[model samples]
Target: MKITKSIAITLGLAGILAFKQDKEVPVKAALQAAQVHLANMAAANTDVTQYPRSTKKDGSIATTSSRDWTSGFYPGSLWYIYDYTKDKQWETLARQWTAGLEQEQFNRATHDLGFMLFCSFGNGYRLTKDPKYKDIIIQGSKSLISRYNAKVGSIRSWDHHTDKWQFPVIIDNMMNLEMLFWATKATGDSVYYNIAKTHALTTLKNHFRKDNSSYHVVDYDTITGQPRLKQTHQGYADESAWARGQAWGLYGYTVAYRETKDKRFLAQAQKIADFFINHKSLPTDKIPYWDFNAPDIPNAPRDASAAAIAASGMLELSQYTGRSGEAYKKIATQILRSLASSAYLAKANTNNNFVLLHSTGHLPGNSEIDVPLNYADYYFIEGLIRFERLNKGLAIVSTGGFLTVN
Candidate 1:
């Protein structure tokens, strides 16, 4: 029973190896690690939160206070897990987290129920064929529809204390239209499709800069559906490209193209992807910084989350464009490899629970600026799983199944 230092180390290493072998490795192992991180986050803050935002001086998270309605990634995190694992535990957690958003959904002021509900319950229903989740998703989509202004032909972005701004449309809002499109398909309602199409068309007309990189925010005339100003709200300035916003535009456009087969959407997606891939701002590793114009090149932080999202979008794009997507496929694989090599935390280490690291949330405000983001972990694992599925030549599941690139 005498334990020497070398013997102790050998036994400990063996135990760890045994544990890892007992469980699944690769994507499943990474998913479990992400869940452990989420659990730790939930235990630390009585809130079973999805994505953690930066805190104010008053110790309050900014996203929690503002009704600006751009919170998308968190609940979507749970939905991603539920779909990947098909675990009832994840489904239960998704439901529980969604329950917290009931008041927000009923407010009739927020425009991102698609981000909040569709990514959570809308996805849940699609995967599990659960009627209750579908009901909630329908209600949430209707709430989002009520924010649409017929005069402006765009959904209102924020209804907070700003009475001066009306029909503010951010490029990021384009992603939310997916829920509306889903509502039209699920319920056979043409109104939802019309509204979604209107928003996409309006964004297409106003959001893109001459460089094909997009503006972060656009102000639309509430009365005549005219473009007032193209500004950058969360980016470096009114013109600089925010890396995450670009990923959103790329991913959103690809999804829109998938839904409508609108040649225009595919073209926009290609343009954005081209802009992103050819940008000088992209790091050698293929991961991008929070702002493409962030000064201090060597010291600039990498947003692994943005890379993960972009990788998934690029893979989707590869499937859309037959032979033209080869470059995107290569870039997507490079980004995923970089993430796995640098940011991914192995499951053997119990001290660090998060699967992916070095994700920048909001560097300007110094909020979760360079930390392991939950959504980063979620999307990294998702990209891996999807890549594996694609390599296996698996069919892309239409109903809550693994979405793969050809």
Candidate 2:
């Protein structure tokens, strides 16, 4: 080897690896796996632009139409893939999948218009500067905020499932506030921004227990603007922590802190992280059971979805604090490493083209249990992209993406 460029480059790579962190994951492999998985999903669905929300037990893709809350995630994930790998095939898939949800920009009945359009069309607009996607996102934000009740101080989460809940506000609704915040910034109007802050403040007042663990749902009385019940629909009990609900709180508050620079939201996020990481039930691997209160301890189903969301949110949260932020980054790195392991990640061409396996969704309701959810895949990709952006000194919610907690 007489100083050939190939030999010099190999030595240079070795020198670079000398300072590499042990927890630094090769998420590029995950990206390649995603490309293969998405291609398979496209072929399996056959011209349908809607996303695959879950995989059936028989290994078939269960596609969700644009009306479903999870319909945006598949396209959003594809956009992240394109952003990460610079692969144009992912761009094409992103656009095609996103087109299916165009009708959702005007759907005012559901609060998930943010999840439907912001995660898909918002990302599309940010990455491509497409005016059409921007228009859709603004319209979708108006539709999402239309569900907000000033008296209740929160957005109404459901309309069809009102038999048990009136003026329902679930922890999951925290995730939809980002679209409102982005809309205010894009339009130079504060009405959407004000509604987001009010909803977050109301949730902060009522949703958290003393220990900082959050309830899954908070049902408000429509007339008096009072909380009639503080119970759960999908958690193990009225007081138990639903894993993904806590994650949604964490991600939501982190986003709010970034947008408003509020110390309360930052403190709320730190406390929620303490509750999650220091909990007795959290597994050594950092992945959590579907419910912290589940009867089965070691035998409970793990929610990789929750772990993914927390990892992405924590990455953004780390930017807000100084020394404490380093700890958050370290734990988040460990989570990424854990999620990239064989235990959580699906093998190539397996798991019906889903990225991760063994996620529990609404186990208490006996639905979507032990399945791969579209949102899980979306956040997993986000964790990877956010990590890359952090190293490059870029923003976590690249182009008005939001995160929150507690």
Query: TM-score: which candidate is best?
Result: 2
Would you give me the overall lDDT of model 2? 0.81
Tell me the lDDT of model 1 at 173.
84
Which window of 10 residues has the lowest lDDT sum in candidate 2? 1-10
Off by over 4 Å in 1: 1-29, 39-75, 161-164, 344-354, 397-406
Model 1 TM-score relative to the real fold: 0.83
RMSD values for the candidates in order, in angstroms, are: 5.9, 6.1
Best by lDDT: 2
lDDT of 2 by residue, 58-159 (tens): 767788778999988888887887777676766877888889899999999888887888888988887788899988899888888889999999999988
Q: Write the per-residue lDDT of candidate 1 for residues 1-406, one digit (tens) a residue.
A: 1213353244335544544663422444445545554444344445543334433445443335213243434555656666666767667666666556554556577777776666666666776687877877778788888988887778888765366455678777877888787888789988888988888888888899899888887887767788877777776777888888888899889878877788899999999999888999888889998888877765788788789888888877888898888898889888876775524453332323455767777676666666666567656766766665666677443223345433
Q: RMSD of candidate 1 to the true fold?
A: 5.9
Clashes of 1: 0
